[model samples]
Target: MKCKLVDVFTKQKMSGNGLTIFYDYDVLSQNKMLSLTQEMRQFESIFVSEVLSKSSVRAKIFTVEEELDFAGHPIIGLAGHLHEESGDVNPRTWQIVLNKKSVKVKTKKSGDYFYASMAQGKPEFISILSENDKHAVLRALNLTSENLADYPLEVISTGLPYLIVPIISGIEKARILLPNFEDLLANFGAKFVYIIDIGNFEGRTWDNLGAVEDIATGSAAGPTAAYLTKHQLASVNKPIIISQGRFLGRDSEIEAYVEAKDNVITNIWISGDVAKVANIDFV
Candidate 1:
């Protein structure tokens, strides 16, 4: 099997989230894929199968624990890699079909760099966590109620579910001491919790399935931007820069563009630069 390791949401070689893309998707069974992801020990790995249509490809996303229906950084990284391998510097669009849905990803080459963007689906506002649940979440993070901002703690989804938490203070003041993620997820009905810095747009996400921390979460960025715009915190139809992965040293920058009309969000786009690391042949 051939694989490529790419860093997503950042152009720098050791920055952003590292993903391994397996080219021989059809040969691996579900259990084999899971074992490979666990063996790689990266945040996530992707298996790209044959093309589904003229420009659409089939792919599966998996973490060490389970397969994800949709994920952000992997899609972006894979798009850039595919374009690079095809030797096509021209701008092109491709659709990646996951278990739940298909997302359109666009890539364009400029000079030596490939810029990739994913068009996430319409934002889904699942629900708002209650005050009691919010307090419990804060406590789990070793934060108090005062650390929370005026905005509601919301469960939003572009593909996967995330609890968007708006912190009144900077991301520096935020800490992760999640003693029990299962309880929090059960209470909030979310797959993860995204703690956003209300001022700087920086975010930190902790998964319910015990992911220590995601270096750069491209999937969460779309819904986070939508949440800010819907509540008038961010300017609608404007580009918002989201910073993540700073604490763990692999800093990443994600660009989010959200369009809204009549107080309803219509579209969401998340983009980032990818850096190709190395290609490996594992038999």
Candidate 2:
């Protein structure tokens, strides 16, 4: 199998979320894919099983533990790579079909990297945690009541669900302690928690999946943008610039926008830069 290692949401190499794109991945069985993902141990590994069209392909996303219905950075990175191979004719939209739904991605090449933008589904507001549950989450994050803001802790989903946590003090004060990890996971009703520093655009996310921390999460960014827009915290027309992976030493930036018609947010789009790191072939 041929694998291409690419970093998403960063212009520089080794500074963003890493993804392994397996070419002709559909040839492997599900169990084989799972085993290979575990062996690779990247944040997320993607299998490009079939190139359905010039601008579309069938792709599957998997973490080390299990296969995911959808993921953000992997989609963006794969879209960028596909865009690169698509000869410099005219810009076209690319579609990636998952088991449940298909996402459309548009890419524009600029100098060295391709800026990939993915259109996420409409936002689904799930639930807001209670005060007690919220407090428990604060403890899990190694934060206190003082660190919290007046904003509501929301469970939002663009494709994948995430607990969008607003940090009052900022991301610098936000930390994830392993001891309280499971409690937070259960309280949020999701495996991932995306903590956004309301003051700055900085953010960090921890997932209960095999991968603990993500450098830049596109899936979470869509919900984060929706959360900010729904709360009137950020403007829909203006892009929300989110910084992540600073704590992990891989600084990345993700730009998100919520498209609105009349008075409602109809669509969400997240765009980021992608850098190819390496290409390897396994015999």
Candidate 3:
């Protein structure tokens, strides 16, 4: 099988989040895909199969742990790769079908990199953490009320549900303390947690085990943008720049745009630049 390794959310190679993409992966079993993802050791891997058309394909995403119904970076990275392979300088649009939904991504080739953006559609305001749940989350993150911003800790989802924790400072000091962190999030209907430094426009997230911190989370960008716009911290219809992966030394940048009407968020878009790294042949 042939696969491509690419860096997402950064124009520079070796920076941003690394992704492994396999084409014609429909013949692989779920267990085989999981094993391959673990072998690659990338933060995530995507299996692309069933090319329905020149501009449409089916994809399945996997972390080192398990399969995901929908994710952000993989779709963008896949679209970027497709654009590059097409050898087209003009912008192209792709429809990526996942387990949960279909995402539309627009890809354009730049000087040496490709930029891709996906329409995440309307944001879902799942729930606001109750005072009791809020305290539990703060404790689990080694944070107190003083460490948080004035905005309420809320759960939001574009594709994956994320508990958006806005903090004022000490982002470097935050860590997941509980072993059952995933269970903790499940109690509040969140699949993951995204802690954002509201003032600096930086964010961080880890796996459920908290063993690995994600370099750049395209999945979280849409939710963070919606959270900011909902609270009036960011103006609607403006691009919000989010910086991530700095602590890991990868350094990635992701941009999000939120559009709203009557103070209700209507559309969310996440965009980033991708750099092609290398192609790998798996025997």
For all candidates in order, the CA lDDT equals: 0.85, 0.85, 0.92
Question: Per-residue lDDT for 1-283 in model 3, tens only?
Answer: 8899999999999999999999887789999999999998877899999889999999999999999998888888999999999998899999999997999999999999999999999999999988899999999998899999988899999999999999998799888999999999998889999999989899999998888889999899999999988887888988999999988999999999998888778889899999999999988
Candidate 2 clashing pairs, residues 3+ apart or interchain: none
Tens-place lDDT per residue, model 1, 1-283, is 8899998988779888899999767888999999999888887899999977667889999988889999999999989988888787688898998888988999987665579989996899898988888888787776777778888989999998888999877566665666567667766668877899888888987566444678999889988998888788889778899999998899999999997788677889999998888888887
Select the stronger candidate by lDDT from 2 and 3: 3
Say which candidate scores most in TM-score.
3
What shift in Å separates residue 235 of candidate 1 from its native position after superposition?
Answer: 0.8
The candidate with the higher TM-score, 2 or 3, is 3
Give the TM-score comparing model 1 with the true structure, all chains together: 0.95
Each prediction's Cα RMSD? 1.6, 1.9, 0.9
Q: Write the per-residue lDDT of candidate 2 for residues 1-283, one digit (tens) a residue.
A: 8888889999878878888899886579989888888888777899998778777899999988789999999999999888777766456689999989999998988877888999996888888998998887777777887877789888899888888889778466666765647555765666678898888878887656323777889999999999898888899877999999988898999999999887588999999999988898978
Off by over 4 Å in 2: 173-175, 178-188, 209-211
Show where candidate 3 strays beyond 4 Å.
none
Runs off by more than 4 Å, candidate 1: 173-179, 209-211
Question: If ranked by lDDT, best first, what sequence of candidates would result?
Answer: 3, 1, 2
| Best-first order by TM-score | 3, 1, 2
lDDT of 1 at 3: 91
